[model samples]
Target: MSGKRYRLQKTERLQLKIKLLVAHGSNCWWCEEPFSPDDWPTFEHVNPLSLGGTWSFENLRLTHESCNEMRANHYPISYEVK
Candidate 1:
């Protein structure tokens, strides 16, 4: 298979974000801090996409843009939704 990764559509991202917010609240999954107006919220893959993670909701999370960047593509030892 080609190495190209599938990108989520804008609408699909928005829908997933809404579902994440409802299921896990408006807090950063990595930092556990509430998103501020100035903070950019982003979808994070619990299992890094580089490590073969999928775009499904079960593997996604809402986190601050900074947190996601800091995390990069490192796979965590354990993950639990709060």
Candidate 2:
């Protein structure tokens, strides 16, 4: 199990994304901006995986791809929704 990594399946990821979108709308969790046609939506972990975060729905939020990338693997101190 040391070299093996666990990842969400495509269908599972899609389901989670859809559920998050329906619950939170298309807003980026970090920036609180609605997603535009040019923006790509992605799921971000509130606690980074590097810090032992799980892929559970409660730990995930919707964000822009760019925002997620900017966040990287840092742990979030607080989530301010503007």
Candidate 3:
């Protein structure tokens, strides 16, 4: 597979991971606001996955698209879990 195709596959799998989390509760963990599947969510890293947060529930969170983008590659900002 081409590098681009591989990346797309990885992205799809990552999206599936996010979907599983959202299906249980399609809302922002911190803000407690519902998020539609089509609304676009951020696959937030609880402890900066690179810093070692797993793909498990405890280490993931769903947030607004913009919120996630703002946090890209940055340490998680403190947010209350509702």
Please identify which of the two predictions, 2 or 3, would achieve the higher TM-score against the true structure: 2
Candidate 2 wrong stretches, greater than 4 Å: 1-5, 78-82
Per-residue lDDT over 29-71 for candidate 2, one digit per residue giving the tens place of the 0 to 100 score: 8888898778868989887878888787778898988788887
Scored by TM-score, the top model is 1
Clashing pairs in 2: none
Residue 62, candidate 2: alpha-carbon lDDT? 89
Query: Model 1, 1-82: lDDT tens per residue?
Result: 1223488778977877888999999889888999987995898888788899878778888898878887788876553333
Error of 2 at 6 (Å): 2.1
Q: What TM-score should be assigned to candidate 3?
A: 0.50
| CA error at residue 63 for candidate 1, angstroms | 0.7
The parts of candidate 3 lying over 4 Å away from their true place are 1-15, 22-24, 73-82
Model 1 poorest ten-residue lDDT run: 73-82
Residue 24 alpha-carbon offset, candidate 3, angstroms: 4.2
lDDT of 3 by residue, 1-82 (tens): 1112112356765775556565657776556677776775666666665565555555567777766665655665654332
